[model samples]
Target: MTTNAQQQLQRYLRNARYEVLPLRGVVEQVRELPAGTTVTVTSSPAKGTEATLDTAARLRDEGMHVVPHLAARLVRDSAHLSDLLARVSDLGLTEVFVIAGDAERPAGRFTDALSLLRGMEEIGTRPYRLGITGYPEQHAFIPDRMTIQATDEKARYADYIVSQICYDPNTIASWVKSMRARGVELPVYIGAPGSIDPSKLLRISMKIGLGQSMRFLRKQHGVVTKLLTRYTPENVFDELSPCLVDPDYNIAGWHLFTFNEISKTRQWAIEMADRLQEVPA
Candidate 1:
């Protein structure tokens, strides 16, 4: 590889972060990560917002910087938001990721990420950093225009944007450019799946769509010798290397979706970091 390209790739890997679902045993999985690694725990309808906070608290106690997803729809009102923020402050958290959440109905007045972000300031202790979501590909339910508008609105309140998982590197690269054209300049954390079982990834891709399934297969062709075996993010990272460090893109780093496969993902990250260090940059 060219020296410039190799240097960019190394920079991206060095700043990589991971996202984890709030599921059972997830805390133990997170303990495997190196101390100081930034971990963002996701909130889901199944696990609830408390689960996300609980996981983040554990990670914090483990000496890692934790960014918990505080889903707006799940929060009941200003009182609830205040309590959550106080808890976060007590834990010494400096960052959070806000989302509209997957709940079918809002639990209180705040229904979107922007509303919640505004509420965050009202709580008296604002996190040092806040993140909102971006979608490179169209969201499953929301229209493209609406999503763009929401992003633009939320960007004002957010320090950064974590993109929804998109498999195609070219699509991600183009989307980042479009975001800048639309005047949203928040640094983007590109989301990619970690070292997950191929079968699980396929099931998820199929649920997303046949087109995404095909793209996943094609993208993994270079990384997975056998289709049903374990899959890593090497191909996606390699393909995205250039855009990741390009000044025009305003790219930050990775938000690896570990899917609770933290052990394998952590090992893969270590191996990749070692390999990058061995390279003559």
Candidate 2:
């Protein structure tokens, strides 16, 4: 029998959730989402954080809830930080997600997420809500202990935690347990991939350097390879169902990494919601 927690998890996913990179056609794609739907824009080393904020501004203008990723290593200094803040303020942005970024080297004094969080405090125009990244599985380059320490340190400044893309439910559940054990209690938005074909999925995975996860997925050759064929979060949602309802887990919702496959992903979410509605939830 599915538990009530599982049901809530399924229902939560039915609500609009999208994570988009700053790419071509994204604005048009986001326009199709319902008003006030949550949309997070990602920062890319190649395209820069400006692209993220610009996309967020357009979404905000269109009446959507926009959250821009503020990559720490990308900010040059306090002046740059203030300019970025001013832009978001002008756009009426209320939330932001902070990360250490994937840059090979820091662009300025801020080398990590905590530094950027502190800079926001000093600037005194911080967003109403702040988010930090969490990794259920080990990060490709950072040690697990370092990742844990970073999460713990940044938890105080964050309103919520959006986990990095993780394919294993067991790993996610276990990570939640570990978080609680270590006293990190922010609400978590579990990350899942949107419907993406193999070629595109591999491209984004490589672009983001998700080495450890790609390796893990590759070990399950049939399933991992098929992820290239037609990707959906059906199995992922099912596996995460129990965790959502568990009193011990502070799971808030889902964060769908759409990878620019916005239209198809939205359709999949709608169909999944309808299917869940027909079931005994």
Candidate 3:
């Protein structure tokens, strides 16, 4: 007989996106992962888009479902965009994460996520799934209205929205309701920081563009921020737990920002899933 815990894990495992940091241990971690793992590799706009493409290829060769992050600012023109699509197709990559990457300046012509999304569609690149970032907290550069509009625009081509990390559950829950009210009906995969280390989590957040959320961490002495590394869904699920009993929010599952501390993140997830089992759901 299948245990309730196992059943829950199976259900979540079916659709969850495992965000793999493109670090030294990624290939090793992917090699040992089970078949169901669909890994999304996020890259820096400053680092160059090809790195993300290469990471996805490596993950694909390891027989994992790989989703590459295509930072909008990094994509130059139609030819560069087409080349990426062709490369992705050749690598058997079926999903991609589109973001207005954290770059001091655009490498070329593209400026934002919507522009890149439009380019991909016009270029005829149809991945099985496309994901865009959602910010619950105040965005650093853009206003909230523009952020919502951006989501709406990208929602046309993207299959899902992966939320940026927000410490407050109320912000997330409220954001989800607000998103639906606006008719941006893409399925949402909540981005929860995976268990790693406090200091590392702080460094990682700033490195990957947490923006205003970083200020909160600074004020809190990195208390809430530490959860990004020291705990997995346990911290986030606590915030979203009410949704499990009654689906108030459209959170499909979680997109763990496992900052390449794969083993610790994996262990925390396994433990949390097991703990959720005893809850008698």
Candidate 4:
């Protein structure tokens, strides 16, 4: 018989958003997703906000629900912010994910996600659904207390939270519980890496400053060996599925970091969702 948790996992997999980069051939890869899929375009300091916005627009035109990342540090000032928002509006996009970003220094007046949120509000134009980043584990540079405080403040402007990629289910659950206890009740989308090569995953994880999660990944002896081949989030799903059905977690759904491996990730998601449905119920 199919367990309730299994059914929940299936549903989440089906509805989960696929996060993609603004790299070459990404739009074509995303086109393979089922109609109406929600695809989020990530911002890269190397590529600039224009790349993110342009890719998002292309995906939107292709009939996908597109949410582009608006890295605060990439935005120059209020004028720049307004221009971006106008572009989003022109594209008919209703959602965006805001982050402090990976930029070493602020490009303009907005230094952080919270400041960017305020800037959006000041502009008197904003997406209907706004997402902000959350940290299940301690950030590499920001103190835990400060992250918490920032989230609490950003909650006023954000419609939801997408956690930074985390490998530990316990940590994610605990963080969600803590957020609730602290009265920040926005629905959370758990971030998990899509099916990808382990070496690539590690390199990207390190590049993004996932220090604690990298340590956790390193400590998994068996998983480390598997790194010679490929890595899948199957283990992560198996351990975290139970939390999906629990009301306390309020997990909106998975936010699969496809890392531009859309074909492989989409196939895995489809197969998993199918497997769940085929189970006796």
Candidate 5:
């Protein structure tokens, strides 16, 4: 018989969202995913918000449920925000993820996710579903107290929270527990790295300032050696699966950071889902 944990894991895998970048050949790779998959388009300082929206629009046209990131630092002002919101409304998109962005300086009035969220409310053009970022591990620049406070404040306007990618299951579970203790009731979607090259993953993780998570990986016996080959989230998932059945955690599902390795990640998700189904219920 399938255990409760197994059933939850299966359901999470089936409904997981795939996060993709707005880069070359991404659309083609996304086409390989199952029909109506939720595809999140990321915004970056280099590519700008237009790239993210354009990619999202294309994917939506191809019949995928697309959620584009709106980087606060990149938005020029209220006019720009209105224009972007209009475009999104035109596309009939009901969801979006807002981030403070990686840009060194704010382009205009909005400097953080909270301000942008308020700005959206002021203009009366907010999406039906808004996602805000959460950090399980301490951020490189933002202090822990501030991160927690900001999350508590943003929770009022957001429909959900998507945590930053963290490899340690204990840390993730503890963070979720803490969120509940603090009364932030938004459903969380755990951010996880998809099946990808270990070396590349490490480099990207470092670049994105996942210092504590990187340290945790280094402490694992033989984990660094495994970096020469491929890496998977099986260990993390196995350790975290039990939490999926816990009501207080309210972990809605996984948000796989495919990093544009859609083919490999999609295959991994499919195989895992299949394996879960094979267990007798």
Candidate 6:
């Protein structure tokens, strides 16, 4: 029923979900990637949805399985949502990652991610897979209880949860357990840093209000702030290893906050996974 090669390939897939923040020439980043690895291109409320959909379509042409973040804050109305979904269908895209998105003020009727998810369901735009963010640590702006409520509501629509990158593996393990206790059974993609310029990553994390990931930065303030630190997936593995090796946890894979640092992160992961194989597995 199983082969070592098959199992190792599955593990590699388990550890690869690239988080693409919209920045200078992200399309180039997408075009250069190894085929078959999932890439999620996130759109902020500030970034226009048309721009995102267009980019998604282009990446689809390149044969990347791009899951575009349809930021609810940016969409204007049902008509706009319809157009967006139509684009996805036209591109043959199957997955979407929905987020409430950060807009200083709502540009349209949809206020949060759940509303958009509901709209998608109502409009008959049911994607094959939908992903939502999970906060292992507290959200800075959204109160903890509200965060739980929001996630619960989204669980009805989303297929899986991707965490805001947290450095502590113990925290990740505990949070996953907590989520299960709270009855959120959707599988999770553990968020983590991928050996990039830690300061840039921290700045971006704080800017995005990435909840626990920001706190993770503050936790390492003394050392991180001064030096140009590089945080690798090892921090995540410390907690994730137990789950990855266990059956109960069902820790699906990794969601890397590439911060558009794809070359460095991807290389690091390839090398790390290779090294793991050599360590007497």
- 1 versus 2: better TM-score goes to: 2
Q: What is the lDDT of residue 214 in candidate 6?
A: 47
Q: Residues 9-114, candidate 6, lDDT per residue (tens digit)?
A: 3475445988877666877876667776688887875567766777777777777788989888887888889988888877888999998888877678889899
Candidate order by TM-score, highest to lowest?
5, 4, 2, 6, 1, 3
**TM-score for candidate 2, residues paired by index:** 0.92
Question: lDDT (0-100) at residue 59 of candidate 5?
Answer: 94
lDDT of 3 by residue, 146-205 (tens): 988888888888888889887666678888889889887777887877776777777766
Error of 2 at 121 (Å): 2.2
Model 4 Cα displacement at 180 (Å)?
A: 0.9
Measured by TM-score, how close is model 5 to the native structure?
A: 0.95
Supply every candidate's count of residue pairs whose N, Cα or C atoms clash at under 3 angstroms: 0, 2, 2, 0, 0, 0
TM values, all candidates: 0.88, 0.92, 0.87, 0.94, 0.95, 0.89
- Tens digit per residue, CA lDDT, model 1, 64-100: 8899999999999999998888888888898999999
| Residue pairs in clash, model 3 | 195-229, 196-229
- What RMSD does each model have against the real structure? 3.0, 2.1, 3.3, 1.8, 1.6, 3.0
The local distance difference test score of each candidate is 0.82, 0.84, 0.74, 0.87, 0.89, 0.76
Q: What is the Cα-based TM-score of model 4?
A: 0.94
Q: Is candidate 4 or candidate 5 better by TM-score?
A: 5
lDDT of 4 by residue, 137-223 (tens): 998788989999998999999999999888877888889999999998899998899987777887878767887776676677456
**What C-alpha lDDT, on a 0 to 100 scale, does residue 260 get in candidate 4?**
92
Predicted structure with the largest lDDT when compared to the true one:
5
Q: Hey, what RMSD does candidate 5 come out at?
A: 1.6
Report the candidate with higher TM-score, 1 versus 6.
6
Candidates in descending lDDT order: 5, 4, 2, 1, 6, 3
Q: For residues 16-119, write the lDDT of model 2, one tens digit per residue.
A: 56999888889999887888889999997888988898888888888889999999999999999999988887888888999998888999999999999999
